[model samples]
Target: MFTPVHADFFNAPTLELSRNLLGQILVHELPEGVVAGRIVETEAYMGAEDRAAHSFGNRRTKRTEIMFGKPGLVYTYQMHTHTLVNVVAGPEETPRAILIRAVEPVEGIELMRERRGKHMPMKQWTSGPGKLTKAMAINMDYYGHYFTEKPLYIAQGNPVESVSVGPRIGIGNSLDAVHYPYRFWESENPFVSKFR
Candidate 1:
């Protein structure tokens, strides 16, 4: 049986967690079925100094409050009609997180297809933040939920031998941080998002 990653895995710097998250498996045991994917891309965001971060300058709000909580929890947010998921990082009181940018479908393709409706190329299955959330059935209800428990969790996966690093995608307001190399992805992975 595959074991879920320990909370300690997330109890580190957001950047470290972001890079290491590549190749990990995100498993969601939904009421309908189980869906799993291999993380192929991630972007790190830090508090205050990192202008791209929602908690920048310690600006905490109801929506961003969970970002300041202990590591190993989910920090889900909605962008338009889609919900994106982030892994809360850093020690308590420190607002930081690693966004799961992309993943390669690993299991439950039928369920993912059912959830996503009709059909799409395998490359488009979970190759973006919004796409993966919909494929895995992740939503705002997961906000602030601990990843160590059921319905959803990250499991140990193959170690990445090499990775690519680049600037994060979107967020045009943070001029200086836009050039920061906060994004990490598995090298040569076609499912690592179109931004790569």
Candidate 2:
């Protein structure tokens, strides 16, 4: 019964969103039922200067349009045939975002286990971008949707302290940009991805 308040959209800037997302609960409701997880790791992608970002250089295409939308919206894309989810950040047209890297399963554990095709321990249930989406039943169809309503949404949860920041992963081509410490996560969360 924890519904996300739409007011989260008022928060501008991807950096704030990246850090604030920690410990927030992400709920995904599908035909089967609801699956929920607590966000533990996130990466901020600033517009233009952040070379690892798709919106870098102000490049706008069919794929990145969601980045230009209002904040608190779900921006999803396909990678390796799997769906990746990001929360739009910054003001309108700013093209900033925070990629949800991992989560710790907190509710609907059975639905997550069934989606993942294995009985993973709670900590390992949603430990990666791809894994979390798969476990929550999110896909391209969810792109450009609102996170405060519909099939997927974010709800308030326990706040995390002792957070850490570091460079993003899997962006070898960005050179120095790859070293930008934009990733944020709960320091004690065991479900954080190993890439950090």
- Those runs of model 2 whose alpha carbons end farther than 4 Å from true positions after fitting are 119-122
Winning model by TM-score = 1
Q: How displaced is residue 5 in candidate 1, in Å?
A: 0.8
Q: All models: lDDT?
A: 0.90, 0.86
Q: List the residue pairs that clash in candidate 1.
A: 48-57
Per-residue C-alpha lDDT of model 2 across residues 1-196, encoded as one tens digit per residue: 8778566543856787788889899998778788889999999999877888999998899999988888988899888977889998998999888999999988888888887877567666688899899889888888878888867999888779789999987888987888899999999789998874
Tens digit of per-residue lDDT, candidate 1, span 75-174 = 9999988899999988899999999999999889899888777657778888889999999999999998988788889999988999999899997889
Model 1 lDDT, residue 159, Cα: 80
TM-score of every model versus the real structure: 0.96, 0.94
* Sequence-dependent TM-score of model 2: 0.94
